[model samples]
Target: MPSCLTCIARKVKCDAPDSLSDCGNCRRLGEECRRHNPVPMVVSRQESKQFTRAGTKRRRSQISCLDCRKHKRKCNGELPCARCIRMKRECEYDTSHGKEGTFHHSYSVQAPVLSSIQTSPSQTSHTSSSAAGYQSGSVNSPYFQSDTSTQDLDPLAMFAKQCPLFPEKELMKSLVQQFFARIAPCRLFGFLHEPTFMMKIDQGYGGRFDEFLLLAAICAAATKVNHEANKQMWESGVEWARYVLQQLILDLNRISVTKLMTLVVLHEHEYRIGNQSSCFLITGLCTRYTHILQLNVEYDNDILCQNSSLTASEKESRRRLMWCCYVMDSFASSGVTHLQLIQENKIEIQLPMSDEHFLFERAIVTDLTPDTIDHRAYLVRLMSIRNRILNYVKRFDKDRDLWDPQSEYHSLLSSLQEWCNIIPENWNLNHTTIYARKSQGLLSPLIELWIFFHLCYLDLYRVVVPGLSPAMRPEIDAVQIAAPTDFLQSSQEACFNHAVKLTRLLEASIQHEKDGPLDDPNIIIGAHEAIRALVSYAKVASSRINDDTKQLLAELVDISVHHLRLTQKRIPTAILGLRRTVSIIKNSGLAYLNYTNLESDSDSDSSQERPGLEEQLNPLSQFSVAARGLSERHGKGTSSARVGSECSSSQKSMFDDDNLLSPGRDMFPTSLEGWLTSNQFGDFI
Candidate 1:
């Protein structure tokens, strides 16, 4: 292969060096040169020569056009390569024939037709036009388009179409189906560390643009993984992802929330484990994301190179971005952590270039004046996510309440609030800047609720009942530091209010739709099904845990899943239904974990060797210990501080809850601040 320039000027076959820069022909041409691919890449010259030399030489070459035939080149072998033949360029295609008509061979190809090579369109280029997705605009581009419209039915009208919400039991069943369905096992998730690679890494993977899509996918996957943890540094996770995206938006010289979440899910995928190329790609993406987000506005260099339509530097920047997408998607559920990389002795990876772009037109598109149904649907999704968070917090609640401030549930609590926080608090969703705003009320909450279910899967809590735990005293002791009152309390209250309101609105909208028949099958689905499902939630909220409510819940979930499966719908709605199912499945897992905790540990060694506090203080543990702790708080007149001793902080402990010491029954905590709060437990979230 030769540089286009070298292959053009020469009257003979231009065997340019296997390097992008300073090819052998460039020196002869005496022109400033560059790599045809743009990026510095290695080509195998040795293997090419080996193939050419192994062929026999022709005794006599045929005469051909001066432009096609070069000095010392034998005819019989075609005067030019097959590429020239398709272009209708005049060339000799026949090789020299022997006495009996056997053909003679030649290692060297003849000179190319300069005019044809430079001017004619190659067959490969022509074929791509007919290929869908192969030459797609979005294949290499990051952004998509968005529009603001409110002419459709209110989102709440489609509530019945949403299925699989309420109670952990139903949620777990659906979760397993969603994750395992239509996906390859284990291959979907794995870990990779570049240092551990056995050979040199291949840097090329199309252009930077391709890398951009892949990188965005990687980031999204990574975020998904962090969300799955039983316990997480939720704020840190959110903040870090936020930090990366903010940086990326600036680097790409654009900002959109849709791309942000998209990247988060991408980067956290499980498929990338043990994948060297994938890791390198994400590092590149981080660079671009950081460049755009961190650089001062004045110093921002929109231009990186001038010759090409896209600046070379900017092209590379897109590559990094795409690489990020790739890494995210490859790593989600990969079970590979930074720490694991060290343990596995893998290499650190970096991104080459993807030559991709940042596009997030859909999430950013917003409108004003969303209908009543739309608003209600948004409330539904938000509430659903909030409940999912409550489910996680409930695992550590010790009490069977919706959420506990000091418990690990707060991690999910904060994340849920933050995710929903992206939605603007306005009646109209289309014009709002938040994710919920642009989603046309119905879609926003539904999709978010799916994310909520995914997050629950991360927490390994098995508790079906938290009240059984003795850690929650009949009354709170003074020693335990209560969770912050302002955050979770306010969040939960707001969530409940919004959920109830949304449910009612969905009911009204569905009834309104049932009033008339429509062409779309989903329209039929829009009728009362959503309302009936909502009513089931009301039953549970009111503590009407009778068979009727449970049956209603099952019905709601069933209806929603059925509609989603049957209807031709968009990704957001599809995502919601799938998530509801996943939640159903995940709830089952939690029940198992909880039941295990409630049961006795069969082996004394297992009990003594509990690796973490979660196992040790589980509901099955002796209540006397907590009772004694409660009694001890009565002995100590003064209250324990929320912060643990300096020594304790430095040492690794199973699960430190010094903040959770009891003060006494006399100073029992009723509400969060007034009564029980984990003392030594620093931010519970």
Candidate 2:
């Protein structure tokens, strides 16, 4: 046995001295020896010539010119094909190949010979006549050229064909009525007028793409809330609406208020269906379009009069549209790193009139009073006030001596109280009998307003009281110490107390299964705020105060979990959000400690008995894991971000009435990052 060539090249001995077989080096390394030649190839001159011709043909196909593919013509097997030479265009062939013999081309980077290509055409003039349109400036004309893709797939035409398949005009009329009765009165956003909308429907708005899309969105959302139509109808409506909007989006220049309204409604529909990311993306576009239309402009009487093209009623609708954008933007950005789009001080327009006057297009407001205004108007005013308060908090420096507890914190509290005091007596929480008729209608907003009112106090006081780590002591050291005169300390207590009360209020509001207040997205966000405030307080308070708050926190958690269980069939994302938020809290270790006996336990016993944060957080962690498993199995997507504590003046609490809580501020999760890093919550998220 002799050594293989590979072994000889490496200067290593190949040992096979015992037998005449493959060498040890070749066998072990699985390398062919080729050291001994067994036979030699023999070919006739004619055979070699035939092989050469076959190789030439194969290489010719591999190196075909680019001009052949673009014009759908055959290449002449030349470097510069006859067609390329005649047309004076570049001809390229991709020759790069990997070890596996796969060709990679960057053909798209080269200049295209034709501006546009027809997918199908008669063979008689495929190439020569196709360029005629580009040369004649037909491509440059303002009139839209018919696109084959869109021409064949008209959503409206499909709807028209399918219209008779579903319930006819009666169903459409019922949906319209239901939208006005429940959805419009809620004033989710100002997209339509009762009179104008009804008139359009009477005149047959089915052919108008913008109006059709809006109607689809309205019907989809209304069906979900009221359940008058079958689920399939709503799903089909959403599908058609999405198709129409996608086609319409190609012409961004043609976007109108109606189109924007259609988008807003679609955003709501997607949100209602628990499509969180898609819903947020739609709102992003909606916000961008709102700015493009300058809906943010606060047109006063003089400005309105100057613009003769806009009627007074039109001006009012614009104002409503602007405020609606503000409200929706505020809601979506809350507790997230996103920035709120619209600002308050920049808007100087009047609040929308009562729904009656606005919907009827009344020319004048002779005897209108504050008490008679729409509930939505109250929401606008409250949001405006919250915007100012948010600005104040953003500029506040904890170390600054100018911080006035009475003037700053108390003033905000008084404003909320004033708002509560001024609403008509029948609107008061105590007058439940008066709300019986419109309980379903009024309860959602009323609970949201109430929760927001409490949350406002919670956010304001949390930052001020028990003060964060580096806060400066108050300047009024000489002010009478306690004996019922220490409003600052009283305000501090109010923060924790409000946190407790807010949770109870939410629990109470959700008792009615159908019209539960927790069904509102903002109200659920309010629950997160309540939970966040309580957790922050527990972490910051002394053992005695922590003991009192622990029970309240536990109660709130039960209330949230129970409420989610009830609404899970309707809004599953709410459950997903709750699970993530709870997991975050559990990982912080605050969720497990029994504050009542924490001080009494001997240090040695406590060390042995108490479980680690991960151990205590297991239930929430397991629940989320199981829920997510189910979601994946069922083809559902959960929210990636969860609501958390204020963390900083820059980052808003989920509880803020408006996402504009920190005006002129861009959020950074300095507090959240530090907290998560310390607790290793990053692994969980």
Candidate that scores best on lDDT: 2
Least accurate stretch of 10 residues (summed lDDT) in model 2?
130-139
In angstroms, give how far residue 619 of model 1 lies from its true place.
Answer: 22
Residue runs of model 2 more than 4 Å from their true location after superposition: 1-174, 223-238, 279-281, 297-314, 332-338, 365-368, 391-395, 398-403, 406-411, 433-440, 465-489, 516-518, 538-542, 545-554, 584-685
Which of the numbered candidates is closest to the native, going by highest TM-score?
Answer: 2
Q: Look at candidate 2 and tell me the lDDT of residue 495.
A: 72
Give per-candidate clash totals. 137, 0
Candidate 1 local distance difference test against the native: 0.29
lDDT of 1 by residue, 1-685 (tens): 5445434434445555565556555467464444343322323432232222212122233243333454433333332333234443333222333554422111111122110111111122221221111221111111211111211222211111111121132332232222222111111121111121111112211211222232323333332321223223222333333333433333343332223323433333321121223333443453344344431121123333333443333333333333333333222212212211111112121223111111110111112223212232333334334344423432343543434555554455475556455544453223232334223222323332333233232222222221212133322221123435454334333433343333333333233322211112212222222322233233324443456644544444444444434331211223322333333333333221112212211331232222222222321112212222232232221212122223244322212333233344322234556333543333332
| RMSD list, candidates in order | 22.0, 19.9
**Model 1: lowest-lDDT 10 consecutive positions:** 113-122
TM of each candidate vs. truth? 0.28, 0.56
lDDT of 2: 0.50
- C-alpha displacement of 105 in model 2, angstroms? 48
Instruction: Give candidate 1's error at residue 327 in angstroms.
Output: 9.0
